[model samples]
Target chain A: MVNNKGLLIVISGPSAVGKGTICKELVKRGIDNLELSVSATTRRPRQGEIDGINYYFKEKEVFEKMIEREDFLEFARVYDNYYGTPKKNVMDKISNGKDVILEIDIQGAKQVKRNYEDGIFIFIMPPSFKELKSRIVKRGTETQKDMDKRMTCAFEEVQQAKYYDYIVVNDDLNSAVEKIYCIIKAEKCRLSRYHIDLSGFKEEL
Target chain B: MVNNKGLLIVISGPSAVGKGTICKELVKRGIDNLELSVSATTRRPRQGEIDGINYYFKEKEVFEKMIEREDFLEFARVYDNYYGTPKKNVMDKISNGKDVILEIDIQGAKQVKRNYEDGIFIFIMPPSFKELKSRIVKRGTETQKDMDKRMTCAFEEVQQAKYYDYIVVNDDLNSAVEKIYCIIKAEKCRLSRYHIDLSGFKEEL
Candidate 1:
């Protein structure tokens, strides 16, 4: 019952594969018991990005200090910036019985896996690589070379799906969200997660 | 994908814990893709029992012959009657992409586990031992001695919940059914079970 702790859901997928969109839809459903884990990053906040909501924007020195303190669950340097998941916030929420969903890239997901083996790892996938290519192309902002690079990265990411506990294909928006919801509900029912009070049975005996 | 074979869901629990009721609800919900595996038994049919629907009623000779053929996924003899799950029907349905639900006792479930390790095993449980005892006594057919024997058996069966992948408590009938439904839906999205066609990616590469 209340003895069951909340789940740490680590979701990952290649860029343009709708991982962000699915997470948004899941939140929009108003599931009060769950929260999205805010990531800390040394990268500059983009236009319209909120300081805490979009990302916990941090100075390079502050981020490095955090790494020294082992404050991040998982952190990495990409190109010129550092990004990582803060350990305290996620751990506090889970201990307080709030499920936290962390949307990350494959590399960050691997880090999470090593640190938190009990977390549910889900990989969001495109319906087909053809569709994925078209979606990348449809974005207009990315040049052909950029698209190719993204696609190559995606190909490699998909190979890592075998390590995930669940693979959700984002063929349709609603269906994908529904599948994730079901996964959360079902995971809660796992025998290892649920605590059954057998005191009544002991009394009877 | 059609290549994804159906799941063999083995459900078991203590007696009078609402396993039958939950299965009936699951079927009534028009989960057409799933079918119940009809058990073969040598017990005499009750007043309203049908040949195939209720049980595959068979003569003792035929039941013994089935045993000799190694045709049952799991079988057991109780008192003067022989009961078992015929392997062919279940296997055929699974190969054809139809999920099969096998409602059996813990003993039979353990037998099935030895024969089929890939099955999703679920244990249905009562909210508490008090509730379970009340439910058994409410049936009005059991004498005090019968009730004591049943309660003892149920106590023993409850200990086997540790072996199950999922444990659903029948606190509310509808909620229990919904949990099982979600479990099935979520299981289909497992990376191991799902077949993703990456041919498009190969072509792109």
Candidate 2:
């Protein structure tokens, strides 16, 4: 029989490409033995934000120490906030046969790729340029300038999709979620993932 | 939007590993746009076996010449009977957007592997050595010698599983078939399979 380790599913995409929505739907649909990984952040928790649930809220000094010790799989400084995904918790869960999903940004995904070669890097994509622009427009930001800046950043991020292992377009929420779910199941069958012990097998007639 | 090409799925395993049964169940279960490829043979067909349906029956001279011209993807002569898989038909269907599944012997699979680098090579395995032996025994082979030979062949063939990209243990028929099906769906999402055109996308905010 084949004994497989749980996959570290790293999902990212252009800004507002619905990566979070797809992950939520996958969890809601109930994939067997699946878990969402919580990230550690140095930002102060807002109202209703639960530490260790929403994020492992850490002080700047402690977060820096954790980084020095290489406790995080990936961490980034974005607009004065330090965000990171804790490595130990994820690896521990995976060792215990739980597939962990990490919804992170492109920078975080790149770092995870370097730290964990076995992780499944998935890029969630919009159906078209028109659709991507429309989705951003629907957000109704304060100024056209802000929206334009976001759009340029998204274009740069879209190029990063080439680096990912798989790409699923977020045209239909359920379909995209289903594709990711199928990927997980198929990946479990991959030869690289399993320690198949044929030692128990005999050549007896 | 992403445009994916059809995949060439080559399924093989040790003798009596039930690769045929798995492929049959997959076709019966109706995966979208899936087709089974028919092989060609120099041996005469049995009663009720239709030419071009069961196989592309051919003359010895013709078969040999075809082999010379490299028309077959993989071929072998077993007990003076030549059996081969025609490459053109499979490629045509795949080019037309139909995923093609080929169930062949381990030797033939190896040849296909050399010929088709893009093919999805799947190795089907039994639950255990005991199960493999039991399955061979269930065939009610005429001689203990024959059964022993088959068991030995199966053992040799299983070693080839290491070269495959994926291994599906046929512990349960439905589960195994579903795993292969999921593999197809998941493979469609692979970055290598799609020529994703981001040109159709716009950066407008």
Candidate 3:
């Protein structure tokens, strides 16, 4: 029997919905209580990115081997790199009282939720598609062509909002973060987990 | 399709657990947005108790007739008084976006949960059984025997703590109310009802 079951929170959003930034803030506030599940990737590390911290940087051969051995809970290829989550580490952390946060994409989130029915999925969205496009453009990295592609991608992500356990509109940073915090706090108190004994009823009566 | 489904929150505890006072504060805090479910009882009204507001004062035959017609969600006899919840009012309020608050005993809470899977049950416990007993005694309505019976009832209620979606310890009134408030606010953010569309994925790729 499990002494304590940890909750897995899968967070997904479009590229510029500020999921990463808000996650960093969540971590800064006190994520020591939660284990941030880092993904293993075959992509080359960008400048100033640490190997393990940024990702479990792995060779294509090694990444493929894990897939062959069925070591990953879920894996997918995006752009030119293969990304996957290791199952054992996440489960162990959760069983040990650390809630695990998985900042994965929508596809990966759906896959995880299917396999782990208990996991909570949160989908973040911009206030409006126009706002989303503006934020993506403000990043200053995408070319005009690339910007169009990303905005199109964001609209698609917004459509997946209904599947999430909660939808957090990243209209304002503090408000969104506060909403997420409230969700977590409330989930902790869910009645399904409470063990009430009615033996006292018979004795009292 | 349901236009708006209101949430059902069951607040239950032993006598002197401060459930009544806390619920009062919660109502004052705009839970009027949630309709407070007044129970129907066959007991004669005490002075100043309103006919339909405080409770639906009923003749024993009328109460029995309603029970026979399956008009109640749950009902029980306590000290020769018949008490029950009308099934219609709750369903009507929920369909109108008014969350329903049921302040009942633990037994009623458990029964309601069994019938209404969507019902959210919250258990309020005093700091300890000893403290609970003291409070009940200090109320002066109960003799030693009555106090003992109440303590026994409380112990039984506490055992059902695990049955609730949330547990709030009423050590301090303000903080406990705040905690309850947070739980309710956060529950609204649960992902089950909310949806985010990911159709953007198809467009981008």
TM-score per candidate for chain A alone = 0.92, 0.94, 0.86
Which tens-of-lDDT digit does each residue in A24-109 have in candidate 2?
88888888999999999999999999998899999999999999999999999989999999899999999998999999889889
lDDT of 1 by residue, A141-171 (tens): 8877887788888998898888999998899
Number of the candidate with higher DockQ, 1 or 2: 1
Better of 1 and 2 by lDDT: 1
Winner on TM-score (1 vs 3): 1
Best-first order by TM-score: 2, 1, 3
Output the lDDT of residue B190, model 2: 94
Could you tell me how far off, in angstroms, the CA of residue B102 lies in candidate 1 after the best superposition? 1.0
lDDT of 1 by residue, B96-158 (tens): 989999988899999999989889999998888889989988877888888888888888899
**Which residue runs of candidate 3 sit more than 4 Å off their true CA positions?**
A1-3, A42-52, A57-69, A141-163, A191-205, B1-3, B40-53, B56-72, B75-89, B114-116, B125-131, B141-148, B158-179, B191-205
Model 3 chain A: worst 10 consecutive residues (lDDT sum): A196-205
Q: After superposition, how far is residue B181 of candidate 3 from its true place, in Å?
A: 2.9
Q: What residue pairs clash in candidate 1, if any at all?
A: none
Q: What is candidate 3's lDDT per residue for A23-79, written digit by digit as tens? A: 777777784466678889999888888876778899999999998987887899988
Please give the CA lDDT of all the candidate structures. Answer: 0.89, 0.87, 0.77
